[model samples]
Target chain A: MAKFSGVWATFEYLDEMSHAVEKIREKGKKPTVLSPCPRHEIDHALGEPQTRLPFISLFAGMLGCLTGYSFTAWTASDWVLPVSGKPIVAIPPFTIIGFELTILFTALFTLAGMVLLGVIDTLRHPLPPAVKKYTRFQRDRFGVVVDCDPAQTQDFEEIFKSYGAEEVHIENN
Target chain B: MSGTTFTYGKINDDMLRMLERPHPSYFLLLLGFLTALGLGVLSLAVQVNVGIGYSGINHPIAWGVYITNFVFWIGIGHAGTLISAVFYLTRAPWRTAIYRAAEAMTVFAVMTAGLFPLLHTGRPWLAYWLIPYPNQRMLWVNFKSPLAWDVFAVSTYMTVSILFFMIGLIPDIAILRDEAIRKGQKLRAMIFTPLSLFWRGTNYQWMHYMRAYLIYAAIATPLVFSVHSIVSWDFAMSSIPGWHTTIFAPYFVAGAIFSGLAMVMTVLIPVRVVFGLEDYITDHVVQSVCRVIIFTSIIVGYAYATEFFIGWYSGSPFEKAIFYFRPFGLMEEWTLTGEQSIGFPQIAFFLMVFCNVIAPIPLWRWKIRNNLVAVWIICGLINVGMWFERFNIVGSSLQREFLPAAWGSYWPTVVEFGITVGSFGFFFTLFSLFVKALPPMAIMELKEAAHPPMKKEAHG
Candidate 1:
């Protein structure tokens, strides 16, 4: 028999996604989140390293900066548009282009960061049968779970409940 | 907390008596409003007859009194949102008693402000000319015109501000409606019944109400800063010499808020005294306002210096001339032109800086900022100073532009002056009505402020 357990807490504090990571790391179980914009401080309480994606914004901004300056430089001097007598290496004017690029890329990176870090649909993962009955894991409760096997299942329910799991169940495969 | 609880030092028996009985002292307010409205009507007709020309506008100094009044009202509008969103976000407890009046101030000031640009227009009827969509006239509004952006900014600012005021009012309206119905007060119950929208303070309603309120608050805080910055841009973005400054957007905004907060003090001091809401408003609230005024004043001072510094740095002689001519320039001093000090826009600049910046520092003391008399006086000075800033910026910059030959002074005719007074009245009239219409405090939020939301970890 497989063991089942769930974690529940309000959206900000015991956030499902943050909980899922802890379960998988600590006890080989998956955790989940049921809300948006969980508090930053709660990441520590949940024991999950901040791993999602705001850094992509910085990376994209830097990349956009280089691309913007390069394009501006090339168009003004390298490509040789002979129709007008515009200055080559116009750094002041290109600064405006750089500023615009920085804003555009930073915004795009923030959107990309959210998609990559958090799974939108919680049910798609292929975990062991133990997590199937733990749908309440995303509710207003917080629990830490450990997967137990029949060989180690001596009073498994009591042990899990003592550690603050609201409910524990066995899944038959 | 003292007996007066919040606003005044103590809640005296007389204050309770004043609140209970409808004394003529309180009723005299209706007379003030009527006189204000009557003056406004008569002056408006005269203003229309004489045209904007009689108000002392010329080609170069075209923006004069009307723009000054616009910036002033917009600045007056700032304190409402500041108290509502920023104070709410930071969880300032005292915001409960003061936020409603501030929001009312915001709505009225915006209404007053929206009129000035129309007044500034040569053809106020063609005010609709700012609209972008092609009409029978078939001419598209120039997207690049700063004025066109203003039409969008001011209208949107008014819409959002009204919504924020209304959203904040809903629960209080329900409370008042209930009180009126129970007491058998006909007029109030009739006025507020439909507006209550069937609120019963259920958990579900509170949840959704809170969510919507937070969203509006979030939107308003940014809008407060952005709206005036857009107004300042109408001046700063132009290639005109004194008008072109990068620092202007922020400077204008800070000054706007500073003056706005000062106006709040001015209005509230009288309100607290007259209504005897001593327990509702307090010395600490006054002190907090003083602190904000000080902070914004310093920034306003910093902006003044930076403008001169940037002009020097840019090394554009035209820019340099514009800056120099502003205060110290002989041409700016009306004595040189043989006009009275009234026509000297430079006088407006000096007074603006003096009132908005220099005059408020003594409030750093526990005595001055907390003293009702001192605070009221300072608030009045700040009002004067802020009005000067707009005059200095809008009028002087136009007066001392690149084309020296085109420059002339503006002098507001009696009609213009009377209308300006009327706008102030209009602003206050709306504010007074709002005071009576709803509880001035966010009673729901007060619960959380008095007691922090219980963390689930407490149970854990």
Candidate 2:
């Protein structure tokens, strides 16, 4: 089945949570921190690299531009209702189509990328039940959930408390 | 959030409270708009059942009030994107409190605007013919046409706007979802869970989510300019004297932002008062918006002067005649012949000039612009003016074309008037429901902008 054993700590203050995060990482554990809002401090402490979402946006945008230009050009040429000396497939007007589609595709694909990547990440690490119970973590509290053995639960709890955690739940599944 | 201090929990509670059952007056207000919407629906049904002739549109004046309304609403939608996307890219702090409502306005305004073209067509069923899909006839929509371009631009603008708006809402909805779970509201929680996309505020989600938001904003920023520019081209591409001007794109865009900011202020002022959110939607934001309004107003005024200059300077009698007819319709001839007669186009022209150019000039004064009541009135005037501005451009130009024999005047029929009122009702009704249904402010973004709760030791 699924494992729910971990140490879930909540801090009222951002600094205290960042301190707890640093201590947990020093102890050779990667702690999953949650907050009501994303913090630059927490991000800096976690030291994760930038996401690849921009690449996806760029790729989608280029695809949209190419498709937009080609589709318009091809359609106009195929259905030759020759206007008064205007070019069969004009560049200036077609550019408008390309420009609009670029934005549309870029926006749609970027959102898709965020959702897909987030789903993959969620699958890799299901949320601990104890962490889920503290709904206040999405409101006023900042949380750090780290997995450890049943024996080390006490040690982790003390470390959390030492860093001034408002509450700590030790789960031994 | 700049001058105000709010704890994360307080922010959540304050915003959620807006979604709670409002005062009795709120329902009455909703009822009034719903009634107006009903009237609009009746009118539209009548028009559809009878014919488009119920509207005051004929040859030379076929693009009457409906096209004017289409341009006006589309213009109104631009400021929302500007506030949400452009302000976001620039990292303007004032946008935090105001952008959510503005985004909602954009979506709803576009919704209201989309109805006009369908209503104008008299056969909304065949509106799908505007699309470029292949059919049995092997016929495709003309790619060279600006109307075809409008079909793509508007739909794309609407889609991008909704997505950008929704993406911004996800984190806030997640908070609301968690709140529901905490309160034991199972149904509310279940509803919000999917709407939130099961957001958990994990670092992984934030990382990707933040980057995606930036990318969307970046893409949407240019879109803000292009969509309205494309709309302006709908008229500019035509050979109409007043409509065919190089300055129309920028001129329309500036007016769009001007009128849009006025609208945002118009709605936000009352909303902030009603919800007791003055601290969040502060005076500073209003002043910033007023400054933008002043800047755009000047550009709009400049465009007006430029148009007159171009009319006279181009040495084209057609352009000159249309310009002269706009402000002083039949005045030159009427005065020469000693006849006292004035046209409706003259009234529209003066109203446009007064509302768009002269009315906002008071905002240049810090004392006047700072007064919310004053700001609201100016915005209301600008809205009236902007509509007339469109009318003057579309109606006056078409009213007196190249051939005096082809000259005719157009006034909106009662049915056309009902439909116009209905579009407003539709917009306001959607906005009323939106504020109660969703967080009118960007809760997470507000929290991000605020100083986080920190330990005394951490402060050092």
Candidate 3:
């Protein structure tokens, strides 16, 4: 089992949360921030790199386009039903299916990418017990969970309280 | 501080309260919708058992009310994707308040629209034949046909719309899961937890979620244009006089958006009132949508005029005959009484023009557009008008074809009407359930848009 301990602090304001996150990081501890909505200031403070979901969508879209066109062409040729005296391999009309499937697959891949990546990222750093204590983190509250040594918990708690934390809790896992 | 009157906690409380508190009116309305849906199922059953002959469609006018309703519902679905996906891609902030319900409308409307083709097939049980799978018969789908394209387009649109809707719901569902956990609703928490994909609002999750949403938005934009264009081609690809025009694509698209915005208004107005979401949905949002309605209505009106002008200018007797017969049916002679003399097609044509054109003109005034009651009534008119427009196009054109001998009038049987009513009931029922279950407004998005509070001055 993954073992860790931390101090979770709930902030009423984004600026306060941002300050607390910076303070935790300055002390060389990894801090996780949670808020009801995505905040630019908090994100910048966390310094997480951009996700590769767009590239995944693009690759999936290209595959979808190829599959759409090739499947239609292969199927048409397999059962060579000449339609209305037109060519057996109709590229023009087949493009519609290709276009639609490209969008469909891109959307599907994007959803898959987001969910898989999100779930993996979350599982890697399990929810800290401190964060769990305040359900408002998923609602209105902005929170920072600092992974710190048990001996330093008091110092972190003072830092969070000075930064206008509404509540602070300690949890070990 | 965000300029919003609501705090994040307040939003959670307000939204979750809707689920916990069930007003008597909700049950009563649900009962009404369910009854309507039951009646629709009964009508469909009658058609299935007694044969599609129970419908008014026959001979030349083979596509009647069913096709009309199909196009109408499909058109209604367009505004949702347009407002949600297109507006999001363009970074329009106003979409935040309205897109959740609009996206839901897209899903339900498409669901309702998908049923018509099956219902019209006379043998709905074999509807699977429309799909192209490797079969022992060694036959392949005719990819050249617009009908085939329609199958692909509609299915793709439905899948993508549903995915987009579901993805947007994840964050809100996580909030609900948290709320349920706090309130000791274990069953609700159990259900919502997995659905939320264990969202913890971490920076990594937000990064991926935002990127995926942008990609989905980008892909969905073209889909809004293509699906209806393909649907229009189901008629335009034919050799039929009125349906064969090149203008059909743009005309259909504009009309689709026009009617779709109207439907969004129709659905949102009552929802805004019932849920008391006026502060978020706002009169400004309603007016902004009205502006879109006005623009699309003009395009539709122009398409209408161009169709008539082109018919008269083309000098083709067949085209002229169809165009003329639409507003003034079989002008050669009428021995019937005064009321009967004005035929069904003529009445449908006039109503289409009046509802689609004349009724929406009032939206030009800020006074009329700002009033919820007026907007609702106007949107209802546009909805009726758009249905008649489809009816006129499908019924009027086919009723009087190339040869006069083949010309015959058509009207929908009671079964067709019941099924149409049921489609509305079905749409409303799904919407009602959605409102009660999910946050009608996007809670996170609204919270994001709100103005943050100003920081207090630093103490000496």
Tens-digit per-residue lDDT, B128-169, candidate 2: 999999889778888789999999999999999999899999
Q: What is the TM-score of chain B in candidate 3?
A: 0.96
Q: Give the DockQ-based CAPRI class for model 3.
A: medium
User: Against the true structure, whose DockQ is highest?
Assistant: 2
Write candidate 3's Cα lDDT for B128-222 as tens digits. Answer: 98999879987878887898899999999999999999988988999988888988989999999999877788777888988888888889999
Which segments of model 1 are wrong by more than 4 Å?
Answer: A1-173, B1-21, B329-342, B447-460
- Which lDDT tens digits does candidate 1 get at residues B13-77? 22223324456754589569767867876888777777766677777676778888998899889
Interface RMSD of 3: 1.6
Winner on lDDT (2 vs 3):
2
Model 2, position B310, has a per-residue lDDT of 97
Candidate 3: where is the Cα deviation over 4 Å? Answer: A27-30, A148-155, B1-5, B332-341, B453-460
Ranking by DockQ: 2, 3, 1
